[model samples]
Target: MQAVNGRILIVDDDPIQRRLLEEAVKKFGYRSKSATNGAEAVRIMTGPEAGEIDLIILDMVMPELDGLGVLERLRSDKIPTPVIVQTAHGGIDTVVSVMNAGAQDFVVKPVAPERLNVSIRNLLKTSALEDEITRIRKHASGTLTFADIITRSSAMERVLDLGKRAASSNIPILIEGESGVGKEMIASAIQGSSDRRNKPLVTVNCGAIPDSLVESILFGHEKGAFTGAVDKHVGKFQEAHGGTLFLDEVGELPQDVQVKLLRALQEGEIDPIGARRPVKVDFRLISATNRRLIDQVKDGAFREDLYYRLNVFPIWIPPLRDRIEDIPALTRHFIARFAAEAGKPQVAGITPDALDLLQQYRWPGNIRQLENAVFRAVVLCDGVQLTAHDFPQVTSAMDYPAPSGVPSNSAPIATPAPHHAPAPHTPGTQISEPIQAEQPQSGFEHQAPFGFMRNLDHDGHVRKLADVEEEMIRAAITHYSGRMTEVAKRLGIGRSTLYRKLKEYGLDDNGKDAAA
Candidate 1:
């Protein structure tokens, strides 16, 4: 069992149930608090002493204020505490309703200690995961920094060394990387590690701002300088005095703005649009770009001098896919983080298959996409584990062949061999033995199989496989909007094979199926 780092709040009118839950949580090494009803729970959670409450287990059938009403009130009051609903009623409809009402999980009482522990453990794990992701983002955006930039890869290690040396200087720095890579993060880390760490680290998105306002936004304008100018305004440069200014997507800046920027960097002063004299200022410049500024300079779209100035120190952030080994760590980190923020304390971890799918994807959007995927999975997933079904969109987006070369449907079904001893044969008698099946020779046989399979009981009895293939096929066809080619790709089968299977299963709505 994992060490619990959060406080559990048990809300129930019955003293026995409250004590039962408190003791159960304490057995897992977690601290506990109790409330008699929804009103009391709300008061305790919102009061000055609410700092210790990390999660709540609310009884759904309480007197005066029921669980649903409490949920509504909490939502209305903007209390962010995570709540798991408990009730004696157990049914699909009631569970769905409570889940829809923002309850983390529904437990049928009398509460099983193991079930409660599973819920609480998963939630805390997810909370920690999300916190770490947010911390990474904040660290990348200049809010936090440490010695986390080191890398084992020689190329990245060299880059880290260079970044460290650059951080010690006051010269302007440029970071270049692909979209979604942590260029801005590296820039922030540099600022945080520099002597100017105490001062503000102002960031400006050059690509997001309008071209017309680019100059005026970076260099302040005097009153009456323009028609809309009501008073003298200070620009980002002036605001960043004695601090660090980060220009994200610096390659998008106009050539004219680049020229003025070059002048400011060289002279350490800026002349307002209508001002007669230039004002001296001191600040470090950190710029990032997904585009190649050297190419932009060669194309006459960027100032050569400005490029050289910003290039005095350079660093590049690698994409997430290049560091595939780090996916497990990153996934765990993000899951814990978002779980805490959403207040869902019962989500434990991703299933092994789900984690495999995550690691296999190319991650075109890099860490941002991974974080969003985990967030979506955590919210939509049921139970303690996140399954592949929870991330249907992600699985559907990937176009890789199934791990086994065989088609998804044709994949061999698994049934446990009987444990009983082989039947005895008469000595020296002409006896025939049941034909022994040939073992699979492929390397894939050594690895666990993918796709749906029949469940087995503890006593080793084979259970019927759920017949959802038709529904899955229909959904796949509808998802592709009746495009056979797309549906085949998503299902990881050839078009001809998909058509054959659809016809065999009577999944095709049209009278005729696609030609082989």
Candidate 2:
């Protein structure tokens, strides 16, 4: 599915033209909210839904507030939504005036659908690219702050709050999250938010370095300190002096190195190899690891003392699957970036169905996985918008039917049946499937189609409330792969209530909850 093209606000007084424009916008794969006049348009743009409106199609002439007036109001309010002005007169002066008033593009009245779509696509693409470029610059300059984090989920908001609090002082911070949940980005933001802005944020991936080289690499060595140490070397700690040092995958450090790391954090200094005395280094420490350091400590793989020293202020970033609400925004951000990098200016947005497919999958690799997926989709996309067909791997994993007529070099994506089972005779084995213990006790043996609940009974009347409720419970169980906790949370009910309903409906098989 193509990403949601964008939300457009159409402002015009003529009812016929408004309806026509609305139809054209819908046909162009964009969702739109309409305003009868310019004043109403301004209100919508400044109201709570302002962020949702991506572009505006304003009539040049309207009562109370004209196109130029609306542009002035938006500019004064610092609302930068791209605008396209339309007028019946195609005078050069009108075009120039609209351009000067901050409209991105101008169109003649009774605009051709093709031309209008091109304008909207170009404007949205330009806006997305500009935002992406700004983010890239901030990230590269080590000036990225919490405000630069692209997120819309409440789960991430808590993470940001903790990061902000940790940034106020030189407290040791340990960022805990799965790989690719943006731990390094969090560390960078903390550094930028603190007094160390514009300072070096030296990152060392502990796991990526060889065990023999880890010690020397982290602490500078004098010339001829070892057999291969011919030249003096500066270590990560010294490089991060007066700034921030981010130790990624710090759990992988050798036990001997752990002792030195603990001492360095505790003493605010390090003993360089072959040095006359220990060198005092002043730097903030921020460590990140995908593994639970406590578990490593329990297993005696990581030193307990070192773990405690590094974990002064623990901030756990929720995984992408846990913060599913952020997928759409993150998807768009990645699409914009990759499209710009790939020079695919025409590739603007994704279809709603495509976005839905992405949200349904559990991204075990977190944000990194999503970013790669969007990058690949953008590269594969031949049209202006990305569709479900572009993400064949994801679809196949979910057992979704491959879109008709699109060619693929990989194995065909499977089609799910009404019972939520993949059709047989496919070459590729199914990755995972929804758990089904036994036939549901509700006795609607003929299952409603997968992903759709029955709204009417066999007699053409509305289904019984209890039956519908039972179907919903069953569907939720399957959709979440029998993870009762997630199912309950998504269903907006307490776990106890969910379990009771499962027992009441005879949907629970013994021991499923224990494993889940």
Candidate 3:
């Protein structure tokens, strides 16, 4: 079952019943409070403690004002909270009446904790879905254009085109690429291009939010819902009403959260913290990740249901290495941009050799690294053009050959050049030789073969063999286009073993070939 965020408010005229419900919420790892009547509940809901509540358990029959009456007040006042009605009266008419009155779901007086939990989960799921629908509607009518992105690659251009089409439709979109490949930018572009441009584009970094706050962040809470909640704070779902909600690093969302998120997509409403009702929202969901989500589902880190919901339309951004041809255009674009920004008209362009060096190197960090490199070069350039000497040699280290006369037994061996033997001279001939010294390897030695791995050794300990093995495995997978079976065979391991290794390395094989 799905896990709901833990801020619940229990309202019952009977003290015993309210206490029982409160205890149940606590037993299930939720934080909750109790109210003797609907008036008290609403007062607490709108008070200083408003931001901590996620759901409300309201008793239908009570003194002073009935549950339906309270729900009407909430709706009329525009209070966005999910309310579940509880009544000793267990008739279809009663359930239907309360439901039509804006209650998300209704439960009998002798409700089981499991049943209550299930209803709450379903309500929260529906709340999220409604929010997504609202966001989509708002974005579809908005202004999303390609001019917002900073890139010259045709790959990016295609992405923008796809984004425009996807934004216009209600279909869910899955954006896949390496980290720092601008997946979020694509999502933003889609939002901008859609009808909901006037509405807020809420962003939820699935990887950044702690597991505990995932529910409250998505569905919002009522006032006094928790210990620290000073006031009501709308969640991303509510905040994105009639707009777009982008879930970045979606693969990192916890398993339980995935289930609820899936339900929200299936439904179209969300149960807010301490809310006695589920609010309907209209929003679009645009999700992005560097991970292969299908693999995560297979490995049980992500839900299969959620995967299907998000995979309706997929857009994969090619890495810089795959689109090396775009490097020159990108370099010139960035040079002009940085030069103008830095007020450096004298530094007009990059030397051909410098451009060649950049084109030859493999960019593991993708476009982000390339942009940084250009920015660094622009800042350091002293003349009208940036030459190979001005540009850092470390940029080309991955493709450089090793120096001659180095021992083969060196801890790390570099590639050797072929077919360049010098002619032998007679002894004491005193022949003058054209001297060509081997380029120094010190600068290159410390540079990681790919990207960020180089900086990990600042404390001066060699990376463990396991780390090396994992890097090689990842490199092999990338080299083979995420073909796991091919990688397994190359590594001389079984497919199962390879899968286990991938889990161990936190790698997923959904986008690329998992079966070779």
Find the candidate with the highest TM-score and give its number: 2
Q: Candidate 3's residue-wise lDDT over 69-155, tens digit each?
A: 889888887767789899989898888889888887888879988898667655544454344345445445444455445444555
lDDT of each: 0.68, 0.77, 0.67
Task: State the displacement of the C-alpha of residue 433, model 3, in Å, after optimal TM-score superposition.
Answer: 62
Error at 316, model 2, angstroms? 2.0
TM-scores vs. true structure, each candidate: 0.54, 0.72, 0.51
Q: Measured by C-alpha RMSD in angstroms, how accurate is candidate 2?
A: 14.7
Models sorted by lDDT, best on top: 2, 1, 3
Query: Best-fitting candidate, measured by lDDT?
Result: 2
Runs in model 2 deviating more than 4 A are 1-5, 9-52, 62-65, 76-79, 400-516
lDDT tens readout by residue for model 2, 376-435: 999999998889999987887677322223221111111222343233221122111211
| Model 2 whole-model lDDT (C-alpha atoms) | 0.77
